[model samples]
Target: MSRPPSNTHDLTFYNGHWYVPSPPIVAVLMMPLAYLVGGKNISTADFSMFFSASNAVLVFLILNKLVDRQWIKLPRKSILWLVLLFAFGTPHLWVGISGRFWFVSQILTVTFLALSVFASFKSWSPWIVGFFIGLSVSARPNGLMSWPFVFAIAMQVMREDGQTIDLKKMFAWSFKSAIPILIAVLSLLWYNHARFDNYFDFGYVTIDGDPVVVQNAKTHGLFSTYYIPYNLRVMFLYLPEIHPDGPWPFLPSGAGMNIFLTTPALIYLVRRYEGRWWILGAWAAVFFNFALLIMYHNTGKDQFGYRYILDALTPLTVLLAVSLGKKIPWHFILFVVLSIIINLYGANWFMNG
Candidate 1:
């Protein structure tokens, strides 16, 4: 299934886009392969293809664990669901084809999320858990937001099994996990220092090479103020402006609306599935909503709705999968089908546009 051309301008950060510098070394570990294959100046399509492949592999690994654990079972006719979910969740159709770094981060974030959940169920060494969590943080700064949930879940696991909390054990785990994360962070800092002379610079600050202060100014103010309110309105109310060339021709634009318009089966799944799994869902939802609030407060274009928070999609999908196991009401199934149609139409419009 080929997607329609994007209307947004291509973003070429490597070509002297000062503030919009190259991705961190940690994030672009695959660039060497890309460069070798394409010899620099790789097409956006190439990048998307690489990202999609990487993401697919990671998604499969994570999903396989769930299937193995019997927490969820893949259905014979579930291929459509998988295709649709992956298509919609991918950044290629939403953020323009050039945003491969974001897609990679999303994949890494989801992988971390799955590992975190896996860790909660088993009695793993603190060091191992820390390593997974730290890797997640290294993938994207936003990974930090999920730490509270991870910690809580780990604590729950300990308490549920009647293990006394040992501060010393916890500290040891923290130190062990911190080592890998520290190395990654240090590497990132070193790259930033070498590139921009600032250890904290993470390329976002360069947004087109303007000074951080200037970019900050452009990202916030009266003009961008309505973005937050607009995002909130669309996210909860399911109203978006129609994109002339968007994924859905009949509905309002923005990807965030999909959350509300998702299949009723999924919604029911969320409502019915309660327990340790619910904790994961809740954590993802809370962090996503928090991220939306932050994005709303800040100024930036909201092209694909709440896609900036797409990193949470995997956990949400897992929750939905778990929920689908319960008896689904017929009316709810109807609602879900309708929502799927709407989402598909919207996705088509987006790709075509």
Candidate 2:
């Protein structure tokens, strides 16, 4: 009993055909690179490194844009630190270098998330925003939650400029805004239908010989009340035990540690945000992912610090920057430094392991 054409990351094999459970945009983008490098012999680790490094640069650019627009005023040093921490102080570094299909897909989604956030601040056209968001969804289904946040920001900007949304204008704008998103969605549907003969099947639940997946499908489904506890542990409370006999003094791998352990700066997000409208929009986006992931079957398995939460990093970073109190809290700085060190160790461990 075997499945043919054996790269099992996102693809599902059924009825003598190959199908990708996730949307195909990422694969489409990689096709050219794969072709150029002689597909059979290319190294995914190399592409993963490229995508990760590129995302770091993109975040640097986005921070620069924010400072230039005076969206959030801070010293240049602070901006640099924020960028560095985001790049190295989270799972992005590890996942980017891991070079697996799952990690690469996340890298793609984060790129679009960065673009969409930048577009929102720059007051770019809804078409541009929709285009990026559509790409985000095509990269990862969880990315669909970003649309409302982007649209809300657009609406807030209009209100500040003394423009209101009336019935006619709202309907016209909604239709215009939906065009690109509709195209992406329809394209994905067509792709799925062609592969699996069903428009709605992503094949996640039907993964071959996965006991957890089978149980999840038959019992509580992909998302349900049963998943919250495991998610809570991985997202908030799970800690690696001291294993002096192991490779490093802690558990080398399996499940994941809490977010606070990996990136302490994100703890800032836990506090109440009494700030601008965009801050709320960002929080809303994070909450949407929080709720969704809380019920998901996997905790972004075999990773460091809950890789699933990577989708929320854009909003989380926004919240982190906005919530920084004046005077550059030294304790916070120490916490962030510790976070960077921890993640660096974890990333190295993950890459080698």
Q: Candidate 1 versus the native: TM-score?
A: 0.65
lDDT of 1: 0.52
Deviation from native of the Cα of residue 292 in model 1, angstroms: 6.5
Return the number of clashes found in candidate 2: 0
How many collisions between residues are there in candidate 1?
18
Superposed model 1: Cα runs more than 4 Å off: 1-27, 41-101, 115-132, 152-168, 201-206, 209-230, 241-248, 251-258, 262-266, 269-285, 288-302, 322-325, 328-340
Query: Candidate 1 on 262-327: residue-level lDDT in tens?
Result: 333344444544566336644665665456454543322333444544556545555655665534
Model 2 per-residue lDDT tens digits across residues 1-353:
34576565445677776565777776788889788877776677787788788777777777676566556666556866777778888988788888777788899899887887777667788788888888988888788776666766666666666787677755655576678888888888887778778887677766653567556766887788798998898888898778888787876346767888789887776677665666677878988989999998777767878898789887777667767744347777787788889889898778675
- Tell me model 2's lDDT, rounded to 2 decimals: 0.76
How well does candidate 2 match the true structure, expressed as C-alpha RMSD?
2.6
Report the error of model 1 at residue 273, Å. Answer: 6.7
Model 2 misses residue 224 by how many Å?
Answer: 1.7
Q: Give candidate 1's root-mean-square deviation (CA, Å).
A: 6.9
The Cα local distance difference test for each model comes to 0.52, 0.76
